[model samples]
Target: MRWQKSDVDKYVSAKEYIDTLIIPLIDFQMDQDLENNAFQNEVLTILSNELEKELTGRIMLAPSYYYIKTFDKDQEIVRLNHWVENVKKQPFKHIFLLSFDPAWKKSEQALDASFVWIPKIQSGDIGSKEMQHTIREQVKQIGELIRSYW
Candidate 1:
């Protein structure tokens, strides 16, 4: 299920069976690395969508959690935890935070949910067949990892 009206409706109807939530953490920064950051977001979005599709009824795909790139990870953790706390009111038992930003790895222990850091694709033509294949493989691996937690 995605973060859309119809999906949420389905999720509400089957809330008991859907025990997992996936929150994509997106980093947006205006700097010389803007292009790379944008690329990462695009790839991560593709991966998230693919992962959701692969695990349809068992997981709810939350809206992408966007944050400005900053050195203050503690502040971001607090904000992220707030989101987690709110969502925890629901019945979700497994909450996964997905990101391509390597910085999250350093603070994973402080996160309220499981943090998955995907390796960033430095540069690529997202529409290319090779890229699509890569994304598909990644989605499979991530889907398997998530299922392992179940």
Candidate 2:
């Protein structure tokens, strides 16, 4: 299920069978390299969408949470947990926070949600065959990691 009208309607009814929530944490790097940051943002969104599509039966992909680059991770924890609280009413048992930002790795223990951090890819042509292949492989591994929790 996804954060859409019809899918969410179904989720409202069949909530028991779908117990996982996948949250994509998007970081907007306010640096000179806007192109690279844009590429990462696009791929991360695509990755999260692909994961949701592949595991549609059991996972709900929430809207990506976009935040500025300067916010402190510790402060973000409170905000992140608050978001988790609202969604928890849906009774999702396993909440996973997926990000390319390395900062999340350090704050995983403090978060109520499980954090999966992937290394940031260097700036590249997002549409190139090589990049697409790399994304496919990475998402496959990420799917397996998510499955391990189930």
Candidate 3:
């Protein structure tokens, strides 16, 4: 099913740092009202719904990361490791780290999770061939990774 960070709010803490999706938007572009918690929840809803339709029950869409950027990589790894270890003790075979920020490529170390890349859409760069190819490639890579699980 499609999933989102807010959907897992009950499982996580209530803190400003618990937000994961808006930082990339703010870091890459102007800080618009879209960064508000309500707006972020809306985006998460839309994305989660779309993913639910796309993946169905074949893959359980775990919640998005709390925050895409971390002040300390080791701490981030430790937190993810805790979550992963919990899931590992369950029936899950793997976890996919869905992220649009390229910075995650660096912070993902020590986390036992696969990844789904979402290309960054900078101002004036959304529809460019570069973005298109990058997004397509990411989609292909995510698909391949998921298929490998079977």
Candidate 4:
């Protein structure tokens, strides 16, 4: 649910997100140079295409989530409800989260939709074809479940 700032700072506001410490490594990539966003956009496009093909359209993406240093339950509820309403107005059937951390489970109410937890490869090493196939099958199984429920 959270985006590495380096992944979205150009498209979104920094105040509304979680800052990953590792983004420092990509800090240079966030420059105001035109090529920066272009490069980022290309990666996003490829990733989006890969995800779309893998999930077969069962997945729904949300704006990134930020941790509140001083949490406000009411404000959080309002924001989440708004997001839910916005998505419901879209062409989506179900919403899911590809989260490496379980804490993101709290956002389940944000979209008022079903969810799936996709595993992460923190090593940045996605392993072999077998591993990729396993992840694909998991996503496909989730897609089938979403279709069955919706």
Candidate 5:
């Protein structure tokens, strides 16, 4: 289930069964290399969306939390926890933060949600067959990982 109007309507009565929340943490720098960063952003977003699809109706995908590449990690944690607190009102028992940013790996222990940091992919054509195959494999692995927490 996504955080969309129709999905939320279904969730209103079935919230108890939808126990997990997936929040994507996106990091990007908009400098002269905007195109590269844009590719990275799209790839990461697709990856997160695929994860959401793998377990639809069991998870809610929150809006992606985009942060400037240079933001202070501690300050961001405080802000992220604020979002988590609000979601907890829906009574989600398991929360996971998905990111390709390496910084989150270091502070994973301090976070309220389980943090899964995937290594960043080198920029490439996501439409290519090879890229699609790789993405599918990675998404399968991530789905298994998320299910492990249940």
Candidate 6:
């Protein structure tokens, strides 16, 4: 399920079956690397959407948690934990934080949820067949990983 009214209605009716939540950590900062950041955001969004479809009944894809790229890790971690704590009130048994940012890998241990960092695709035509294939494979692997935690 996704963060949409229709999905939320379904989720409310079947909340017990949907025990997992996937929150995409999106980075936004205007700088020289703007294009790369945008690309990563697009890819991550696609990955999150596809993953939601692949594991529809078991997981809910929360709205992306956007953060400035240059934010301090300590402060960000505290903020993110607070967000997770609130989300936990919904009875989510497993919360996954998905991102393409390498920085999160360094602070994974400090996070309140599972931190999944997928390597960023430097540049690409996201609409191309090659990209679609890659994304499908990624979703498959990620789905397996999520199921492993079950």
Candidate models: Cα lDDT each: 0.92, 0.89, 0.48, 0.41, 0.87, 0.93
List, in order, the clash count of every candidate structure: 0, 0, 1, 0, 1, 0
Candidate 2 off by > 4 Å: none
Q: Which stretches of model 1 miss by more than 4 angstroms?
A: none
Candidate 1, 78-135: lDDT as tens digits = 9999999999889789999999888989989999999998888889999999999999
Order by TM-score, highest first: 6, 1, 5, 2, 3, 4
Question: Evaluated with lDDT, which candidate comes out highest?
Answer: 6
Distance from true location, Cα of 119 in model 5, Å: 1.7
Measure candidate 5: CA RMSD: 1.1
> RMSDs, each prediction?
0.8, 1.2, 9.3, 12.3, 1.1, 0.8
Backbone clashes in model 4, listed as residue pairs = none
Model 4, position 96, has a per-residue lDDT of 43
- In model 6, the runs with Cα more than 4 Å from the true position are none
Whichever of 1 and 5 has more TM-score, that candidate is: 1
What digit string (tens of lDDT, one per residue) describes model 5 on residues 100-126? 888888888778999988777787788
In model 2, which residue pairs have backbone atoms overlapping below 3 Å?
A: none
Badly placed stretches (over 4 Å) of model 5 are none
Per-residue C-alpha lDDT of model 2 across residues 1-150, encoded as one tens digit per residue: 889999999998898999999999998977997988898899999888888888899999999998887888888889999999998887999999999988888877888999999888787787899988888888899899989999
Can you write out model 4's per-residue Cα lDDT over 83-147, one digit (the tens) per residue?
A: 55565554334444333333445655653544344444333224467645655665566546545
Worst 10-residue lDDT window, candidate 2: 118-127
Error of 3 at 65 (Å): 2.4
lDDT winner, 1 or 3: 1
Looking at model 6, residue 73 earns an lDDT score of 86
Better model by lDDT, 2 or 4? 2
List model 3 lDDT by residue over 1-150, tens digit each. Answer: 324655445324432222221111111222444454433433433444444444443555555556434356577668767777776554456566665555657655555766455644333343467744654555456555566765
